[model samples]
Target: MIIVDPSSGTSPDRIESFSLESDHSIIVTSLEHHVWQELEQEIVCSLKRLQCPRLLDSTVLLLHKLITNIVRTMHRHAFQQAIEDDLNIDIVSKDNVFDELLQNELNTHGDRNIEQFCRKNHFQVTLTFPEKTDTLIRIEYPESCDSSAYLDSKLAKAIGFTLLKQTDTITPAYYCATVVRDIAQHHPHLEQAGHSELLLPDDESDKVLAVFCKLNYGIIVFSSAGDILSISPAILNNLKLEISPTSAHTLTGIIPGHFYNDVLWGLALQSQGGLFENYRIRIRLPHDDSLSILFNISGYRHHDMTIHTLWQIVSLDHKATHTLAEGSILNEARVHNITRNYVPQLVEQKAREIVRLGGNALLNEECRLAVLFCDIAGFTSYVENNEKEESVIHTLNMILGRITKAVRQHAGIIDKFMGDCVMALFREPHKAILAALEIHKHSYDFNNLRMRAGKDLLLLRIGIHWGKVVIGNIGSSDRLDWTTIGDVVNTAARLEKNCCPGAILISETLYEITAHMDHPEIRFSKPFYLKLKGKRNKQAVRYVQTTSQTLLHDIFTTHHAKG
Candidate 1:
């Protein structure tokens, strides 16, 4: 550890004689060097034993600028003269001031750490261990009005270069700010709840932020004070342009109608083959601010569905109102029960309706990737032989609920569940692997909890594979289901069959993706070959082992206390 000593009339020669012990050690002194003319020479002499040429080069220029600015800003000449006169020193030098600043940075108060110093002083301080490529930087004043505006102006100027015409297009930076502003304004109750300020609140903000950051997702947040917070690591390995949420071409999901109408019209529309395809509707206002009644007639079958939902936003207030207004033709409908099994599908369909209303036409591109297939091992025997139907169903639901929670925590979308089997798709390979990891980890905890309750523990076998697969509407003309299909899906199921109870079996594709990820608790067995059904080549499968010390264990302790 570096020891920072505040200058208390220590001579320049004595300060120079102080030994630098460790590579991590540096003696920061606050001596007002009046006699020493060359600051670089003094630092070099002290750091001679330390073979840090790069540090010297990097710090010399930055430190010089900082020290010179500080000297000029603080009018150190007069203060130095008074101090030198009192201490009987010859003159003040640059080395003295530089050492003082460095010392101050390394100081430790009783309970106040270095972070407190940087925060209190509003400094952008970064400490790097060049050899290890490790860096820890405390960026202070991001919450301050001044710093936020400065960052915004900087980001705006950077984004301005990409935009052809300011009026025609919103730059990536501006779009990020706009989205952040919208979230903040409309969702004031949603606080910034993550390791970073830029993260948007999801169901579980911390987990979401961790997964997003790990996957190299860039985030930008807008403060209520109109300041922008953006963080993008310089080196993002294999990160694609489409992964960024702020990208103009990136797709977004939305829900337009109120709770009741949203479920009914959305479900009815999906039932009549209008979920993914374009649909038209007309909006006739019921009252000024009471509610907006709209009618959506299916485009595929021309089946009419009525929706009544409260409108919280007006056309004049929203800049993208024209987009919403142009595509949608509105009609009035009575509100009724919309809640049913297919509610989320309606929510997703409502997102499409917003696009129909003329918001930037939502992209119809299919996200193709891996899906994890999971099922409880020996579930049929347990259900038929031992447990009652209701009890078995309850246990199955509990297992599904626990697994789904883990899957969603890692940002995996649940495709569907057949009996005790779960089909979840991750559009990205990383998400798929992470979801598998979470599932395996959670299953152990769930089983342990069941064991404690004197209930037979249900073992889950998960199979994950990655490949191109179409993700869009499926099913008959009368009913549409958003799902995925491909050879990868089949392989995932086959891999699950090979998996043992309480194990996660993954295809070669999944193992490859998660090979080097830092998951200490997860143990992977050596890859084995399996002759899968209808497959010419033998498939490679590996099982993921988990224990009680997992995410599910923590969640159970935190949430299942009452139960």
Candidate 2:
């Protein structure tokens, strides 16, 4: 059993040195009532001694539930192993007999047999305090024991219940950390035992493809010989294509005359591993109306060296038609490069928005949004002082990656990244604050790594505000930038500029909205006034405080003392 004393000034590098420590180990050899009572008493005393009354009851209850389930599962496995050894046969082949004997022994003997069995196959539980803020419980089983059974059992349900019950009491960071840790521990077992191979069979793949073709876009599959193999109903309906008994089912015969030559040329180019996309054409409809369509073709080579072409046709709106008519269609190679490189950086919501809007027209609208700005403190000095340009850029990207992840996790849209700052927009005021908290937490870890490496620690200052903002395209005709504008954006930036290092500053407007919600993790100071730039009157604001602030301070103090 290993336990690190929180008051010992133990760093992460020294964790392995304390592996032999056994100050927090509890040995369980039976499930009898008196044993549980004694164990609970010890746990209660420990909690009291630690002065962690906030988590006392919940921790006790959760540990009890978890241990109960674990012990039961262990006993069942041990019993099966005993039967198999005595009978010299696989227990699965004697399921009925094993079940009858198991029931009789459990109900009649009442832990007498299981208690003796557990005495030979016992496990130890150890409790550790991580950063003196969270509890880490570990159960260690013997080499011959199968601990995976307990992990795969009802332990997750117990953890879930504890989290739900303590939602309003525990911090969000702790809650998320617990959930993620549990998932990571069991993920390998889940993949090996619970889930099947991810790749679908041929029939399943065909069924999926059939369903996918029924969506809004038109799909057509053809062979290298220009023979139409399959086409979606959407294609025929949207293009008003009618098939007669005498009509040939070939690309040349079925395709419209206006775009047949272009389609053929595109397919020929695709055969040489060249991409063909954004080929625009006009399809004449009834009543002299015309519809603009964009074509994207992809080719797949089969094992038999046969090429299968997949053609996608998207109908364009009036705005997209005008934009395309202005000769703005990108070259196929540029389109391919952009899709492969830049498109993946877009968030899922932004990607969907672009697809829905057909990537055309000015998206000018006024909506109430929460704006967040995050800037790294002392970054300029660090960059100027550090001669290793590559290391500086790497560190900058690492920090920016953490901030980007936090915003994306909270469903916020990243507007842009300035030199040492990031701007994001969120629809929910509470989520924006949550994202800010997450960014600071991640930065704390980064700073710890930097401190250990004898590098200067980087701190972040964040600001969030909620108000109506204009979000749309703003730039020259050649290069348009999709961003947020209005006083709200300016206020968020100003707040960030005036914020203290390693802290978050939020306007009262945002504070009021989030304070009314069920977010006990977020705490704020008394209302304060700030003379923000470009404003006639002082703006009302508050300093956002979190439990992590204390943790960060402890780390800083400990590191500096050691230095």
Candidate 3:
């Protein structure tokens, strides 16, 4: 057993690379949730921006999730134990390893214990948590043929914590299991009914499934009596794209939605108890069972009146993707099993992109990548001078709306949009450089409109850098973001600061690359050296501006002038 108690100043990012397979059971504690969450978002952003999974695979991402779950769970247990001891609530969340359950002092914390118990233990007890969240995770094995043995009685009845795994493997299993005993020692309000089955709240059920689908499917929800409750935007976007070519190409137009009511209604009504168990259903309209939209629907009851359910709908192409290696059709149970494990939305989206690329987009080697960082000139002053929040939002959106279009036009990924800045990544260095030049032209168009409306001009400053940076996910669980890190990304942002209003700056490395490209739009104003802030040594840099021809072409090509 090993214990790691990090000091207050220690960065949680240091623990991001924690190994899943360990020779020793480890207890990691004391990291604050807020700090860890911040680090996680940074790592997530980097991993997504870099597309690290193509090389590092999904294991790194999964390990992140495991470590985070451990830390969060451990914290909760310790907090709960302290709370019970202090409040005298008659509630006890005992720390139970599989070996200790038979001897636990189980009482009725009621069925809530079932959830707590199932969250932490396994039947065979191949793995058990000391912190449950921190010390133990069974990544080595994810399946079990039989259920673990345990005694069920009043004195041993309370199962404190439970979290089940809904995976697609043959050996589907549970994460944690334990018994919680009420002891009837306190808290009269919680024991009014004596024992009530733990049902997930309406909002919570939707939340858990939404979290699950982040990396997985397009979900369709239906009420118990066959009413459509909700539809994900992704499905709706897919339907629109399929139904009409004249559909607007705005990125927002393609939101997920699930309109397949017949399939969902069938699943709910067929469920024995007002709830539909986890099962698979074919998505076919009344006139068309031939369409290959197969989805896995899992049903749960919110208030005994309505059945809330959703499916992991895979094929957005309106064709079937449910065939296995053996050429056999995937059954309902099998489909549900496969999708049981939570897959991040980014991962699934990336996977589909690779598929669309005909499997050649996956790259592992260091590619000469370009990082572009753009910010609104004097955003703080713009906000401070403009007292109305509405004007600030309107102007900011107007600028961002134009900037985002410019970035995508050049095949760049807007890694993230900060309050008034955006970070874009490009495999082609020139695109990043070109994107910067085009953005300034766009500013002119917006300024033209603003001048007509008697408003202040909004200027743009952009910085571009060229270097090899890794794209790797850094944080735990679903709280991940896509970003790229390294000197290149940092240097680009630094360059942006040095840029003049309505101008673009390029690092020496970027100048060397673009200097050779044949484009009349790019012009550099001789190399110079500067002792940039926080840097000890002088570095070579160059200033750049695109010609009218370039901006005009971009304007006419993509119709970027916002009306």
| TM-score leader | 2
Model 2 per-residue lDDT tens digits across residues 1-563: 12233345764223322322235444554444223333444555545544443444555555555565555656666788778778888776237877788878876665557656655544322223232322344444333223321332354443322221122322221111121123334444532434566556987898777766665555555554555566655655565556532222533463555343444444444445533445555444432354444554444444443345455555557546544431114554566576754432323444444344234343344456789999988788888878564488888888999999999899887888898899998866789988988898898888888787887777888999887676555688887676778899999999999998788999998876666667676678899899999999999999886865766855765654464
TM-score: model 2 vs. ground truth: 0.45
Q: State which candidate, 1 or 2, has the greater lDDT.
A: 2
- Report the poorest 10 consecutive residues by lDDT, candidate 3: 154-163
lDDT of each: 0.46, 0.60, 0.51
Scored against the true structure, residue 162 in model 2 reaches a CA lDDT of: 20
Residue 442 lDDT in model 3? 84
- Looking at model 2, which ten-residue stretch has the lowest summed lDDT? 171-180
lDDT of 3 at 427: 61
Question: Over 4 Å off in model 3, which ranges?
Answer: 1-349, 353-366, 549-563
Taking the tens digit of each residue's C-alpha lDDT, what string does model 1 give over 415-503? Answer: 78798898887645656766766776677766676667766556667788876454444566677665666687888888888776555
Runs of candidate 2 with Cα error greater than 4 angstroms are 1-351, 354-362, 554-563
lDDT (Cα, tens digit) per residue for candidate 3, span 1-563: 12223433443322322332343233333221112222333334334443332322232233334444444344344345444566777444444542143223122221123323333332112222222221212322223311222222221223111223434434454233322223244333434544666657997799877787775655444455454455556554533333332332321222222322433444344556545543544434323435545555565555555656554665445543444211113344577578844443334555564454234232222224688989987789778977574478887888887887888899877777789998888766778877877787788777667656755556788889887565545465657543466777788888888887677888887776656678875678799987677667776888887666345334432332332
